[model samples]
Target chain A: MRIVALAGGIGGARFLRGLLAVTPSSEITVIGNTGDDISLYGLRVCPDLDTVMYTLGGGINEEQGWGRQKESYVVKEELAAYGVEPQWFGLGDRDFATHIVRTQMIDAGYPLSAVTEALCARWEPGVRLIPMSDDRTETHVVISDEQGRRAVHFQEWWVRLRASVPAEQIILVGADEAKPAPGVLQAIADADVVILPPSNPVVSIGTILQIKGIREALEAKTVVGVSPIVGGAPVRGMADACLTAIGVDTTAQAVLELYGSPLMDGWLVAEEDAGTALDGVLVEARPLIMHDVESAGAIAQAALDLATEIAARRGTAPQGEDAR
Target chain B: MRIVALAGGIGGARFLRGLLAVTPSSEITVIGNTGDDISLYGLRVCPDLDTVMYTLGGGINEEQGWGRQKESYVVKEELAAYGVEPQWFGLGDRDFATHIVRTQMIDAGYPLSAVTEALCARWEPGVRLIPMSDDRTETHVVISDEQGRRAVHFQEWWVRLRASVPAEQIILVGADEAKPAPGVLQAIADADVVILPPSNPVVSIGTILQIKGIREALEAKTVVGVSPIVGGAPVRGMADACLTAIGVDTTAQAVLELYGSPLMDGWLVAEEDAGTALDGVLVEARPLIMHDVESAGAIAQAALDLATEIAARRGTAPQGEDAR
Candidate 1:
């Protein structure tokens, strides 16, 4: 089946790996969130994109679920020694090469999509990967602390602050101006099913949806979402902090409602959230944790099966045997 | 003494270390060559300035006579893995940090002089280090081979090709439009004596002289130079190839003539070239091999003494007991 997956960082990447195990990687097109992208030490760093690339390409630090395996912080330490700022974000020696190549290409006038393609040439990450948008769209967070009320880059709030301070608001700064990257709309249009992995509802998947035409394109497809919230908390990362910022309850039910029936045709939540319901959407309860590739693959299979059931119920199923 | 020195990489940096040991580092201001500077992987890499900084700041790999001590090549390997070009240039992980910081500063519209000063703050190289020009100036060498007669970056010819091919011509691109960096001319004007270490005359010291008004300013002061050639060969590095490219012989006498009487008041040659002489310039022969700091210090002391003798004979010695 032609599959399209919307991804964030570690959580989404891990889910995609599981998706690949259960499905042909050649059929997958991953639309990665770029709202978390930031310019650090003058190098363009797409943390989410790189995480997906590294994780799928077999270069990820497996224990950490992000960054390159056998990564060295020599460059980071040296940068700090030179007293360059944003010391909280860890960029390893191997990882810096990606940003360097990317920044060079972007400065040379290539779009972000083209640069991502060039980087993927080295990783050969199985599935076709495209960013949410070609234009710059940074996520910024508004908060109040000892420094008083201020807005900081999403990375400054997330990676550096560890989402400790309550975010008053989370904003995608340039989403209104950003167009979906070249293949984004086409991928959704061609896909038999669109999968939203267990990624942050407010930032990762939500940020991509904010991009012009992306949400509209996905809405026309049979979409199934795997809940990031399991047992009333994020399976990984600080998604709860992001959810709280948007005044959304930290539960699978709240996130499913946030995505709504207009976009999601099917929703898969943890067994504990079996009571969660949304009109015009097929809701299924299962074990939502991605403990390993096998477990994650089972979750992906369930999401795909739900998508099939939803497509059949709507009488919009493609004639292909796989889709039917 | 308010001393000024024109420097390249390796030889110049090492000599400055000895000069610092002999005299107060605060008294020395170094005008480093920017000809070897190149933008690699979108980062500004200044070999000469960094050499001077690393050598003096105790961060240099003493054995290699360039780059950082205990450097790792993880970044370079990763870049090569990405199929990035110019893999021949070995930039280590530790060294990459310096370039990244410099590139970022330059992108933010800081001049090379300002960036150099900022980098030096971390190295604390003791002597004030400044590039020969704030404006970009790259040394290009014309050579004939499979690529035909085309000008390649001096680094490409030197580092990648190892200067195995004969250079037909050497050009300093942007020299005509370049001006001496801030404090370069003023440093020469305020100097008691200007020292030319055993740096490459063709690319290093010669490239700096191409900057407008620099040579003229130095000509008005008491100037001394240490010959890079001893026993008709360069003390270190590939200075002979560079000298030949400019149609100058690889000998102490030839380099002395290249600098000429207009710029040189005192020229220190090795004991092997004792008879090397020129009218209107004091030429002193000494044991010029810088095997260690002490030996290099002795050579520096000789150059200073020659400057003092020239100043006394010209009846223009500064009114101080040291000058007399």
Candidate 2:
């Protein structure tokens, strides 16, 4: 099956690992969010794309859920010694190499999308990992801090203040003009199944959806999205703070409603939240916790199986993509 | 007093270490040769400058005589996994980070000299480390391989081939038109004493002299030279092959004659080659073997003292150049 996954970081990468484990290697395509990408020490660092790449390429720090394993800190120390400002984000030595090569390609007149492909050529992330856009699209969180209204880079919001303050708005800087990177829209259209892993709704899926034709492609696919908010709490990271910034309550129903029918066809929530009413959606409640790789594999299968069940019941399965 | 030293790689770095140990840190300036620099994976890597910086900053690998200590190679394996070519050069994970940042800066319109200064700001290599020029000036070696005539990059000639083949010619590509980097001429003009370390004559010191007006500035200064070859053998590396390529025999007198008259007010030779006659040169022979920091410190001080002695004897000594 040609399965295309829309992923963010950590949670998304972990779930993709499970999906890759369950499916054939050549069968998957990952549309990675570049919203969390940042220029650090003049390096273009795409955390979400790297997370997916490293996790799949066997270089990820399994314990930390970020950066490469057996990574060193010499670079950070050297940079720190140089008195560089904003030393919040941890760019481990091994991880820095990825950013360096990516930045070099980007500097060499290749767009981020092409740079992503070149980097993937090194990691081979198994499945193709396509950035949502070749164009520069940064996520800016507008917050009313002590210094008044201002938009901070996504990394500053995420890593610097740890997303402590409330945000008035979250804007994808260049999304309106950004075309979906090559293979992104086609992957969605040609896929037997399209999955939105339990990635951040606001920054991850939301960022990808902001790309010109991504939502349109999703509307045309047999799409299923797992709720990032389980039991009204994020599984990890500061997702809740971001959700709160947009005045959205952290809940399975809220998340499904947030994505709406334009993207999510069949919504999957935890079994604990079974019978939960999600308007205008076919909701399936399953054991959603990744648990372990095997359990995650089972959950992935369940999501795929649910898409099939939802598609069949709607009676528009093969006839039309709209009903499903 | 300000001091400018012409340097190459490991030997240059070791001598620089000694220079810093003997002289006041603020009074020293290093004109690092970029001939050994290479662009691996599109990142401009100035290996010699980094060596000098790392060595003086206490970040260098004292044992390996190059690169950062406590280095890792997770990135290279990742690069190889992706099928990157030129697998011979070992770009350690930590070292890769430096190249990445440098490439980023260079991409962002920062000339390498400024980038070197910026990098030095962090390492505080104590002395200013200026690239001989910001322009492209690569060293190429012409060798008669099985394929007949071929000119390879300096790194390929030095590291890949180990200079095992007979190098017929040593060419500094773009040296004819290359201008001295921003601080290079200034350092030379303001220098109290200039010392040529026992680095590779063709690839290191020879490359530095190729920069426009650098040699002219050296001729105006009270300069002391150290012969890289001792008892007709290179102190380290493939200096003999390089010497042979230029058709200069590996001897103290021949090496001194390569610098000729005005560029050398004095020359330091090893005790073994003390009796070797060098015309129009004030010569000092000493135990140049750097067995430890103390021994290296002695040799460095000897070079500076020789320069000072020559300056004192030269009718009128240059003021504002004492590195006390």
Candidate 3:
């Protein structure tokens, strides 16, 4: 079946890999979150897009669940030696090539979506990957510290500070002006099911939803979301801190409620949160921990099954417009 | 005595190191060639200036006479993997950082000279190093190949082709509009002597002279040049191909005559070329090979001594305007 998935970085990428395993690669379309995109050393770096690309492309560091495998930090080390600032972010030599190619393309006037398409030509990540918006939309976190209250780039808040500083607010700098990247709405409108992989609710899936027409388009579809939080904790990464930044509880129920019935038709929670319910949404609880491809695929299959069930219950068909 | 030197890449950098060994770095000012600079993968790569910087800063790949020591090519390999064009150039991972920082600064509106100074802050390359022009002046070579007669970047000709293809002509694209960098003219006017290292005469020192005011400034100073060509051939590199492209003979006598009396007060040549002569210009023959630091230092001393001798014969003092 044709599917559309919203993704963030590691967790989202991991979940998408499982989705790819359970479904035909050609049927999948990923709307990657560009809110965390950053310009480092004049090169545009999209963490979420690269994570998904590398993960699916089989170049990811399996141990860290992010970045390239067999990576070297020669470039980063040399930059430090030259006394260039923002030395905290870990950019490996192999990883730098992606940003270099991406930045070069963007500077040459191609949109981010086109650049992503070109990069995917090399990775051949199997599925179609497109950024949420081609327009600049960097996520910034407001925090008060010894330097007083100031807003810093999301990467600085997350990678540099390691989310140590409590984020008072999480802001999408250019969300209002950003149009959903070309094909984003059409993908959502044409999908048999829209899957929200176990990505961060606040910054990953939530950020993609913030784009003008995306949420409105997904709201009319059979959208199934697999909760990132299991047993009141994130499956991976510091999703808890991100949720706290937006005043959301670190629980599957609260997150589902935040998504609500209009945008979500099915919610997949862990067995620990079995009683989680929504007024008009179907909730299913099962083993959500993705230890390997098999477990993750099972979860993906369950989400798709729920999406199919929800569509059947509403007397609607789970198929794209062309298929219908 | 305050000294000013015109330089290019490998040969010039080696000569500068030798010059540094004999004279205090604080007494020297180097006008580096920027005509061979090229933008690779959207990052500005100043081969000549970097060569001088790395050589003097002790970060140079000693055996290769360029790039960083203990360099890795992970970035280059990855760039090739992504199918980025112009992969023929050898830019190491460590070298990539330098370009990244440089490109970032250039994009941020800093002049090339200022950026070089900032880069030097870390290298602390002893002597004051300045580009010949703050303005861009890339050298392009016209060659007739299967692609027909077309102008390719000087780097493509030198590094990629190894100058195997005959260049019909070598053009400094922006030289006519290029002005001497801020301190270039002042350095020339304030010099006790101006030494031309055994850099590529047709490209390096010659390109620097092509900048609007630099040649005029040096014409009024005590200038002594070490002939890059010795005994009918270049001491090293493809200087002969560059010379031939300009319809000049690759010989000590020919190169000195190309510079003429107004530009050259003295010319140093190899022992084999004992009969090398130019009217109104003193020609001296010696061992011009820079086998090591000590030998290179000896050559630098000989050039300085010749400049002093030329000034003495002219009944003028070998000192700057202020000293006089």
Candidate 4:
């Protein structure tokens, strides 16, 4: 089946790794969330896209789950030496090259979509990895600081503040005017199963949905979303912070309800959130923590199985697709 | 005492190391030429500045005069994966970070001079290294190619073509309208002596002179120049090709004459070309080959001593003041 997975960083990359192992990579298209993308030292850095790319390309340091392994921090040191702003996110000497190339290409008139494609050609992530849009859609977190209430860049709120402050607003700036990247909507429409990994529901998955027509495309398909919340807490990262900002409690039920039955035909939660169920949606609980490649594969297989079973029950048959 | 020394690449870097060893660094200011500067993957790359910086900051590759040692090519490999243009100039992964920071800073409203200062903060090349100007002054060479009478970037002409095709004309684009970088005129005007390194006479030091007021400043000072031409050939690089392009013989006398007595108080050549003096310029020919650190230091000391003697002859006078 043609599998299209929408993803974020860390959790998203780990889950995608399992998804790739579970099926043939050729059949996959990962529409990576770029809302957290930032321009540092003039270079475009898509943390989520890089996470996915590095994870699949075998360049990832399993321990770090972020930058390249054995990474040198010469660039960051030089940047610091220059007294640059936002000295939180560490761009290493080796990693800086990727951002540099991406930034240079973007400056040379290539949009993020084209640049991502160009970057992915080297990693050959097996699955086609694309940004949700070429538009400059940045996720800014509004926090009350001593100065006043203001929105900081996603990274500033993330790395600098460590997301300690209550998120006054989780704004996906530029999404109102943004269009989904080419083939994004089409992939969602043609997907036998549209899977949302346990990525941050607000800033990650939510950011993708904010892109025009993506939610509608998923709504039209046998969409399945894996809950980021397990046992009333995110498996990793600050997912709950965004959840609370949107007036949703950090619960499996609350998150699923936010996605709603209209957008999801199947909702999979961790086995620990056992009592949860949806009236019209197929609910299957499994051990959803992507602790390792095999565990992630099992979770991915379960999501695919849920979609397959739902498609079979509806008396609808999905086309055979690549597993990548 | 005032000291001026010529330089190019690792040899120049080595020589500069010796110059720093022998002289007070606070008074030193480098007038680096941008003729060898190239745009690799859309990011501006200045080789001379990097050489000077890396050497001074103790980051220079002891083996390779150019580029960092233990560098990775993942970035270049990845760039090729995107089918990026300008594959001739080598930009290693570590080397790339330098360019990226510069490009980013420059794009973010920092002038080239300011960007150089920012970069120098990291490398801390003892001397204040100033570019000819902040303007995009590119060196292009007119040559007979496949189509005949075409102009190519200085890099392509120097590196890729290897200057095989005879150059018909050499022009510094934007030189006419370009002003000297900040502190450049002041450094030159206030200097007791200015030395042109044994760099390419036409491209390296020659390009620096092309900037407005640089030649005038040099003419107004006790200026000294070292010839790249040695033993009827260039000391290093394709200086002979550059010389042929400009219709000059590859000889120390020719290069000294090319610079002319109007701008020269002293001229230093390799021992093979020693004792060849001009009408009004003091000449010294010494062993200029930088075999090792010791020899390089010796060469630097020789250049400095020459400038000191010239300064003494000029009565250690300040500019705009009567020696009487």
- What is the C-alpha DockQ of each candidate? 0.93, 0.39, 0.90, 0.43
lDDT of 4 at B195: 71
- In angstroms, the error of model 2 at B142 is 1.6
Off by over 4 Å in 4: A22-26, A69-74, A81-85, A145-148, A321-324, B1-16, B68-74, B77-88, B92-94, B143-149, B161-168, B285-324
Q: Each candidate: what lDDT?
A: 0.92, 0.82, 0.91, 0.81
- Ranking of all predicted structures according to TM-score, beginning with the best and ending with the worst: 1, 3, 2, 4
Candidate 2 lDDT over residue span B28-62, tens digit each: 78888997778888778888888888898888988
Which model, 1 or 2, shows the larger DockQ? Answer: 1
Question: Per-residue lDDT for A79-195 in model 1, tens only?
Answer: 999888989999999999999999999999999999999999888888999999999999999999999999999999988898999999999999889999999999899988999
lDDT of 3 by residue, A1-324 (tens): 689999999988888888888776338999999999998889999999999999999999999988999999999988998888889989999999999999999999999999999999998887899999999998999999999999999999998899999999999999999999999999988888999999999989889999999999998888999999899999888889989988889999989988987999899999999999998889999999999878888899899889878888898767643222
Tens digit of per-residue lDDT, candidate 3, span B1-324: 799999999999999999989876337999999999999999999999999999999999989999999999999999999899998999998889999999999999999999999999999988999999889999999999998999999999998999999999999999889998998899889888999999999999889889998888889988999999877889999999999999999999888988887989999999999899888788899999999999999999899888878888888867643222
* Candidate 4 collision pairs: A1-A321, A24-A323, A24-A324, A25-A324, A26-A324, A27-A322, A27-A324, B6-B196, B6-B197, B7-B197
lDDT of 2 by residue, A1-324 (tens): 678899999999999888878765437889999877888777788999999989988888999898988887767865666666568899876776677677667767988878878887777778888998888889999988888899999889888888888877999998778888888888888887789999998999888888998888888788888878788788777788888878888888888888887567788888777776655567888878877778777777777877778778776453322212
lDDT of 4 by residue, B91-173 (tens): 77667778877877777788888989888877777787777788878889998877868899888887788888888889998
Candidate 1 Cα deviation (angstroms), residue B222: 0.9
- Superior candidate under DockQ, 2 versus 3: 3
Sort by DockQ, top down from the best: 1, 3, 4, 2
TM-score to true structure, per model: 0.98, 0.89, 0.97, 0.88
